[model samples]
Target chain A: MEDQLTLGGRNFSSRLLTGTGKFASHTLIGPMLAASGSQIITVALRRVDPKAPPQDNILSHIPDTVTLLPNTSGARTAREAVRIAHIAREAGCGDFVKIEVITDMQYLLPDNHETLKATEILAKEGCIVLPYVMPDITISHQLYDAGAAAVMPLGSPIGSNLGLEMKPMIQRIIETSRLPVIVDAGTALWSNHQPVCPPLYLRLLFQPLHLLRVQCGYRLSQNPADHE
Target chain B: MNININGEAVETSTPDILSLVRARNLDPSSLVVEHNHTIIQQAAWADTLLQQGDTIELLSFVGGG
Candidate 1:
């Protein structure tokens, strides 16, 4: 069991990297993070809460144990993705960057062309680029050659909870790539496993948490100490 | 000659790696060189060949936040 994964010289203890987009409130996010036992927390660089006044800083509540993983979510092109990475790096994110060039809003699929080009460029620029690409073996090889620190291949569309749709390719990627391979996006198996929240906002939610439970359960049961 | 960085004009001369970087007047620590869109490793920068019309983008990783 790999307890901590090192990317670009930074050590992270948690394998579970949780996204902060869907959580109802900042108050809940902290507890959920604790519940999830995730050390790596993903945050979108483009979307900042604007309704709150400027004086109120939203980033205060996030615990220090959480290793901030700033993602390039909204960018459509390689240039735009690089620009976002630059801003995040400048904003004290250290050298880590999650490259996600999502061109389709509905599918939330990464634009393969843009992703490869950007990863190559950023790797040259000295930023540790972890790209979220579709399950393409050729792209994976190109990414490794391009100097990516890691490859995050989507299981399904973003937020779809479709666990490892491209199973064979993902397994192949995991086997072949020298870098850490994280199965990112569409791993929403939390609805059933974690029990339904009593809140009205979540009442209509039909998310099946069982998928997430199995994934976490297998990981935790195999090596409980790894979770620590 | 397009531009002279240190003292030597940018030319097609296949100079030694140290001489090439030295002629460019670039600090190896501050800047990263990407020639022809491929990132030149810090260790290999001196040995990397500089051709005429080679598109180089210099990137600086500095402190922020």
Candidate 2:
């Protein structure tokens, strides 16, 4: 038997999804994707800066083999998120859209209500919606009912580097949800010291915990051993 | 004509979307143009003309999580 993660009628061999953010240089992205073996990568859409110097397009760095998962990061409302999703699809970024509706700026906690609303609308629009929400079992079920392809619950606040702060709640969600549960943010394995385990090791460790998948947003180091 | 591009008002004599992009020295293949809140496909850029007070947005993929 082979292990595969399926989303939106497509099968992916690697369960780890990577993001194209916080990188020191765009040159590191290609090698990082190659090393991580991530089949799906997340990107954000923004207005082109007119004053900025001409540079290589971010899409040019990403190989055609990988799937583009464009996120609605800047949206604060369901309507805004829906608009971004439509634009992303029309821009030829495929059907995958990650619904991230954050209104709380201080802690950057996701507004579950707006996220659910966006999920409902985008899913109905034939998008493969993956909503990032707070770790709530009821909300997970609601997302599934809303036709979401997957439910991404945060382990903690975004980019807090606090690994699995809401582990118990996330565990409950993973246990009950029929949809794929992806641990999206605040699961970084660094804290002023060298990481105890590599990313591959962490993936194997997560098996007993029943974590379906994980998305990492760490910068890729030159040395394979120097895992962030 | 004056138009709103990415929330900034700009003055230009460029007629079509393609010409406007060229005038700004932007790569057409690397852009997604939104005219008056509707995404205009690259293939239609040559046909989609700009109008005064029209809102245009030039979007591209960026590094984000």
Candidate 3:
């Protein structure tokens, strides 16, 4: 029984997905990818700066073996998100698109309604749509009905490093969803000795729990009190 | 003719998308060209002529979350 994560008719051995952002230098990306063993990584698209000095192409740093998950991070509406998805695919980023429609600048929470709208359109267009959204069971069902490949519920706000603040909602989503429930953001738990663990350690700590849940048929105790 | 590239108006005599990209010293292989809201593949860049007031968006992959 080989464990693999399937998305859009493609199989990936690694369950951990990493982002290519917030790094001090682009040179570290290749090494990071090699060390983390992440099969899929997220990237963003933006208008090329005309005045800036020529820089190395980001794609060159990424290995061909890894899958690129281009996100619609700057989109504020479904229409904008759909446009970005088309652009990303046409740009040779593949069919995998992470719909991230966010208008709330303060909290950076995803707009669930707009995310669902984009997911419905992109999935129909034959894209492997993975929508990032707040943890909500109703929207999770809606995303499934809209042909989403998986649902990515945030553990907390994006980049907050608060760890599973929305644990209860995420657990509910996991319990009910037929699609894969990927906990997307706010994963860096606080540490006493260090501010946060290295990215590799974070992945190592997180992946086993995910595997355990999946291996056990997701049969965690249903009762909220049972968790205590 | 004057055309918009990435929301900035530029005056250029470059005839096609390929020439325009070269004139700006941009790497064609690393770019995704959107001409008037529709994507233009690299193979089609030479044939895609630029016109006055045409909106061209030049985009590329960047590190982001």
- Candidate with top DockQ is 2
Give candidate 3 misplaced runs (Cα > 4 Å): A192-228
The sequence of per-residue lDDT tens digits that candidate 2 reaches over residues A37-143 is 77888899988998997757788888999999999999999999999999999888999999999999998999999999999988888999999999999999999
Q: Using DockQ, rank the candidates from best to worst.
A: 2, 3, 1
lDDT of 2: 0.82
DockQ score, prediction 2:
0.76
Write one digit per residue (lDDT tens) for candidate 2, span B1-65. Answer: 99999999899899999999998999776788999999998889999988999999999888888
lDDT of each: 0.60, 0.82, 0.79
Model 2 ranges off by over 4 Å: A195-217, A220-228
Which candidate model has the greater DockQ, 1 or 2? 2
Candidate 2 docking band:
medium
Q: Indicate the residue-level lDDT of A210 in model 2.
A: 30
The C-alpha TM-scores of every prediction are 0.61, 0.92, 0.87
lDDT of 3 by residue, A24-106 (tens): 55666666667656678888999999888776688888899999989999999999999999999988899999999999999
**Per-model TM-score (chain A alone):** 0.76, 0.90, 0.85
DockQ (0 to 1) for model 1:
0.02
